[model samples]
Target: MKNGAFGRDLLVKALYGSFKKLNPLDLWHNPVMFSVELGAIVLTVEFVLEALGYKKGVLWFTGWTTFWLWLTVLLSNFAESLSEIRGKARAESLKSYKTAVMAKKLREPLPDSPYDTVSSTDLRKGDLVLVEEGDIIPGDGEIVEGAALVNEAAVTGESAPVIREAGSDRNAVIGGTKVVAGRIVVKITANPGETFLDKMIGMIETAKRRKTPNERALEVLLVSLTAIFLVVVLNFRVLSEYLVRTTGRGEPASITILMALFVCLAPTTIAALLPAIGIAGMDRLFRRNVVALSGRAIEAAGDVNVLLLDKTGTITLGNRMASEFIPVGNHTFEECVHTAMIASIADETPEGKSIMELAKKTLGVRSDALPKNVKVIPFTPETKMSGVEVDGHSYRKGAFSAVKEYILRIGGTLPPELERVVGRIAMSGATPLVVVKDKEVVGVVALKDVLKEGIKARLAKLRNMGIKSIMITGDNPLTASAIAKEAGVDDFVAEAKPEDKLNLVRDLQKQGYIVAMTGDGTNDAPALAQADVAVAMNAGTQAAREAANLIDLDSDPSKLLDIVEVGKSMLITRGALTTFSIANDIAKYFVIVPSAVSPIFPHLDKLNILRLEDPYVAVLSAVIFNALIIPALTPLALKGAFYRAVAPDKLFVYNLLIYGVGGVIAPFVAIKLIYHLIEFFVG
Candidate 1:
């Protein structure tokens, strides 16, 4: 109670102080309600009665104070209007934030509804849900039953649909995908808060908070300039008072000068310049189709270096189908096809799905129905493969290393014919998965993955821009190396886990590289968060987006490069404007001071035929010159005013030359032009 009472007293005192600072008479809307007007009328009456010196009456004092007060009121009103604009923008920002928070809250607790529920709100982690032809999958999941081709472009940024089936290991199932053919059951694993969509939103929010170096530098400069402006005002006020005291008569001359000084050093230009440029730049970014969310994110994008890309969705086509199938073993090719078909029916890998599809096409058998009494083990990254069981005997299939190791443990060797087929497949950049039944070799499944179009040209462009491209993948070394070489990447990190991707990013950073990670999956989330600037596909998982610093709405790598150029140019323009403005100010001090001290420079002080104050003429001349020249140079700060596609180093040189030469020469030209105008007006 005591603390509350004390706080109330403090608040009252502060309000009282503010009231005292502002004149009450100025707050009144009616001019007649002013105390100064009443005082002036009273002075006239007092002069008539006492016949005192007119200057000693209330009229002179009241009239002078009233004029100053009216100016002060006008300035206060302007200040109030500006504050309201700021308040409105702030309120709108708050509304956006509240809406985002509400959306995020809704995403936290997932529903445990039955598998029949297809709504995202009713989905839970690890629930097997059914999806049929032309139906949208409502949650991220894996194909658990049957085979279907799905269009996942909305989630993975891939243009083509992917074929999915049971036992397709580590394949990501996205929300809002349409099954083009066949009926399938998906096992939901990523629920509301943990989903890719949620993460993407979170990444965008984080990007808004990250400050750019240019922004930070500007903030510091603004604070220092504000402090300097305050000091100058205080000094002018003190000088006015000192001059008044030195004079024998106690006149109100000091107050008039104080009013003029306040108007002079309020930093009107600075206040208007900063936010205008920032808002203009932000608007330009949006118009260019870049999702910059905030000024700070745009600035940070200028310096991104190492771009850690997700292999499946970001580099190669996420969709994989069986292009070729090579078989080997003592068993007949028909028996081999039947065993491979049965095993692939229960598997859920890109390779697995392709094999199953080829089997159905070749054998002319329906895959929608599964045989009874079959045991399935889903493929995991750690296990490197997966398989199925029938009649108490395990039929395993996976990576060559995994199959070979298992075969060795069980005291078996790859049949000579199977080894030759596997060798031929490996040479052609195809992964060979060996199928075995009861420790006897069945056949080899050759799977082919297609490369993304124009990837080579994109890498070449990066190299031309002096950026090194690196490829990292969890695929076997042989496959990864082959793909990397084909893509013409500068470096290749093969057999990498998600953690390895993160470590690589950290290592690059330690080596003084600016890292950027682009991924559309949960595994890419951690590395994206750790990168200097992370970009995620708009269709990526919520986690991946949340971890990223930028969002590519269309998931175009080319767009990222464009944003970097724009952001860098923005910083350059800011620096250029600052140099130009400050240099003009310095030159003004030299040009105006000599005229202000003309009394001390009698030789240079020449009164024209009009006989006006030489000092005033000089100040007017300089001001007129500044007004015309400043506007002419404004194009330098405006977007797209200079070079559009110049090299960075050359752009810097050009700007320095242009602004440097222009800043110096433009003022003198303005001064000469203004002098001629004054001569024409006065002569």
Candidate 2:
């Protein structure tokens, strides 16, 4: 409702010369409907009395009618104030969308979405583009050229720069990722509308739509409880009328007065409490840098026991560096580096650039020559490798799987020892690149991204907190498990596609586990949306930024623990206020009922229950008490107050005791004081 109303307001503000005369108050949001509803109810009651031949004096009816009208107006104003706060908070939660536009300063190229690349302005689908060290990726794609350390925390919830090298099966680049080191060429597989970043942001924007069972149940309870209270109050009025008719006395002035008080105190006071508390809780979260897209997510975050995570950027260092150079073709490491450099001179992949950088570092050689008269076949998903021809000699380099297929097509097989060596490297989470020259396998280079600092210790901390951390990835099982064990992950899923990641979250939710998936790239969008909580990286892809609820402004995986703490604290705070408000109301009923009915407390009944005779005094007292006493006694609502006399779990019981037990004593004391005051005045 908040979003819809805000959206309507936005439309109105944007459209000129339409509904220009209509004030915001003229809309259904004003207090007018509440006043009309209350007035109609009062009139209906008067009509019912007249039909039963029990017409009251004009002053009695007029006073009672006027009181209800004002009561409804007051309640409506309170409701609207809360609603406005919520609307503003909801609008602010989406401030990141504006940031996306600011990201345009990076002048990132658009991926092939609108379908024209020459203009660079018209980024068509399936175009391979390059992102330099200082440039941002314009679209989401697989890294095809150059190895780079990319900060993707904005796109993925995890605050980490992921390293991408060629031939790393899990490597995927997202749009808006800042190239921290090296350069990369990305093959744009998804168009702008279909990009991962867009989907993630869309998910975040829609976060408020989902609701948990508890919140729904609470809503039902509020409605039903308010109705029950109203019925009881009405029944008491009927009983008073019955007593008056049986005694053959004039209708009791006090009964009508009590009815007016009940009307003002019952629905206005109690029903107002529920939504006010909820909106206040939301505002508190907003102030705490927590963007709660939905009440369900906020509630779910408090209940999450096991938080499943993705490994690539979540638990381990996401960047892989070129670490080893092994030569097998009667060639020294220098010779191999030279040959590889020549082969990759015209290449633009991250792994190629990493290899080139290694050659420069090791041999201190620099050359900017692309072999003349060269024919190149760019790597495609089907081929899984790329090849270049220079002076009628063809050289190929790519994944072991692709190389093996090429060898078989030519009726050749690798030596058993060589295959075993590659297998061992692959098992250790390394990408094996088999270099082939003149259709004969020459050597292989194995590379892996190093792990992040203190990841194992962090995983241990998660375990200590009783959180079962699971790693999900698209890597082969051997590679996935190797990284998982090294990172101290409790469980893992390998070779999972994007949709599979999302489905896995759903499955975990069905089993009653709260899941959180972190990805700084476009591919992580769906899974981020699927989870109960979506954490996006401050440096991650546009899709991820759009999809998540919470952004790791620092792009660090460790931030999850901090967010969990914040969410837990927020729930505790909400529980605190809920207990206090309900308890106070319950106590009021006990004290006010006994005090008003006691024969010895005639003065208690004579005193204006709501001080309606003087509207300013009554309203001021109610407002001040609501703003000060109730809020102050609401132990949880107290500013910066933590763990006082009561633990979080015991708060509800404490509040009930104060309101129930203390309430009985409170009214008796008040009545006694009133009697004494009246006697002294008479004396």
Candidate 3:
């Protein structure tokens, strides 16, 4: 629909490229097309002899056959060249975004360290850079200190700002995105010309892209078919002689006519469009904001039957927001909300910020500024609790067990209903944070891990396509089971560690299952590497991204569905076109075979269903049709065939009827029409 890449300049360059590809050295890699080129060269030599008075009577026939044969070869080259040109144009557009900018290089990793200003291009790996509010990130790196809200619309095309903080899975930040709010000290992970963007650009523009396994296998099949056809056509020479000796009815077939029949019967249609199909598949993924590192990775996606998805960020929103504050024991709702808000005053995490917001929205309470003589306590994996000390009193909020142990150490006892409340919350797939004032339990804050919208339907669709969905999480069995049921996953792994995730992938692969893993953390790197098809979020750590075969620019865990669909579409398009190309030979056989040998065996006239008056006209018409079909189907090759989510058996039947049967009938009608039109104009 859009032809922006086909501007005047690009079209001229592509046209020149098409002719350059006609060189024998370039054509030799494609056996099917190489044979066609050889046929064209032989015909050209015959045409030259005819023009020089060696074969004076058949000059018109030799000249037209040679002309059409050359046209056919050029059309195939043009299809492949146009596809490459469009890919190069897209790579150029992406490269334009990598402009040099000045960065503040930090002398020390501290927040208050002195810095020097330098060009971002001059920065190297392990360099620490301080980026303040509204400052652009200078390089791809991990946040070493502080937290900030970053706008990554330049890379991910998402306008919403996402949080990047030190010591978290979401700390990784890409160069060129701006820090929309707050400040952060980043330790660069990549050197000049070695960033993620640089690698992506190289992949798109490289001329030495390796063929995927499927492409190589298909080429082998096409080559075999071409060889078989060559032997059959050559043996026709002997068969023609036998017919002449036995019946004494017609003359032996000439080399020119035999070559024409071979070219027409070979699967030239699919061979011409094969390269374009693979290139277009990669381009389609790029359009969807995914960068595939290799053609093999995208092809592997189509065969994936099991999906190992992280529970956080992929199935549920990563942030666990405070939804409700429930009073336990004799505490009132107002008191519980106020105490929870005070305990979270010094907490900078998303859960803490959410608690403060919820308190304000509920009771108009603000805890932006701490009181005099206040001491902030940050949450840690060991303590599992965070709170503030002010006015000689302690206020804290954390996991029920952690907070309970703390209260007991301080000579306090929990209310009888506290365990019941915490169990109920966990069973509902929401985390319960216990709030304490001094030595007394106040209430519980319910942090709900929200399920992403439309996730259930997406998982269901994957099921219908015969893919199993498994959710991985570190939550307890109660919480994990609730979330897994709500998300409609086929299975789940609860209380999973990094090693657990890695083992799952390895075990699935051993069972002959193609597993696709989606993650965005350093802990996920091993599993991502072990999986058959690994997709990492753009916002993930450098380790995870490097281990993945495909990177989702939008950082959406659910984007695997779209990636799978694109892969399936590519495979289906190739299969459908290959089937159609082979079926098309039935029509050409009817048109050319009977007409080519009709002079030797006149009784073969009954096989000429199209009823052409002249044999030379019929042969030329078939040549014209074969050459014209390549360009006619160029758009389909570039765009790929339409795909629907259904069982493989159902899709196979549908394609058989549409492409296979349609291929046979359509060519018969087209070649017949071309014959009459040629006769009317040239007779």
**Whose lDDT is greatest here?**
3
My TM-score estimates for the predictions, one after another, are 0.52, 0.51, 0.88
lDDT digits (tens) for residues 1-683 of candidate 3: 24565567777777898999999999888789889999999988888887887864467887888888888989999888888887777678767767898999989878798999999999999999999999999989999899999998877778999999998878899888899999999999999899887887787886335798989999999999999999999899899999999989777777778888998999999999998888888888888999888788888898889998889888998899999899988999998998998898888899999998998789975545536567998888988999998888889999998988898898999999999999899999899999999898999999998889898999998898889999999988888999999999999999999999999999999999999989898999999999989999988888899999999998888898889888888899999999889888888898898888888898888889988768888888888889999988888888888787788999899999999998899888888899899878886
RMSD of 2: 11.4
Give me the runs in candidate 3 sitting further than 4 Å from their true place.
1-13, 99-154, 159-166, 171-191, 322-327, 330-349, 352-397, 406-413, 435-443
The whole-model lDDT of each prediction reads 0.57, 0.56, 0.88
Error of 2 at 149 (Å): 9.5
Candidate 2 is scored at a TM of 0.51
Candidate 1: tens digits of C-alpha lDDT, residues 142-260: 66567888786554446677666665332445666667887776667676666545543443333233345675566566556655754664675565456456653333223322222
Preferred candidate (TM-score higher): 1 or 2: 1
Compute the lDDT for candidate 2. 0.56
- Top of the candidates by TM-score: 3
Order of quality (lDDT): 3, 1, 2
- RMSD to native for every prediction? 13.4, 11.4, 3.8
- Name every residue pair that clashes in candidate 3: 250-600
Going through the candidates in order, what is the number of backbone clashes in each?
Answer: 24, 44, 1
Superposed Cα deviation of residue 595, candidate 1 (Å): 4.0
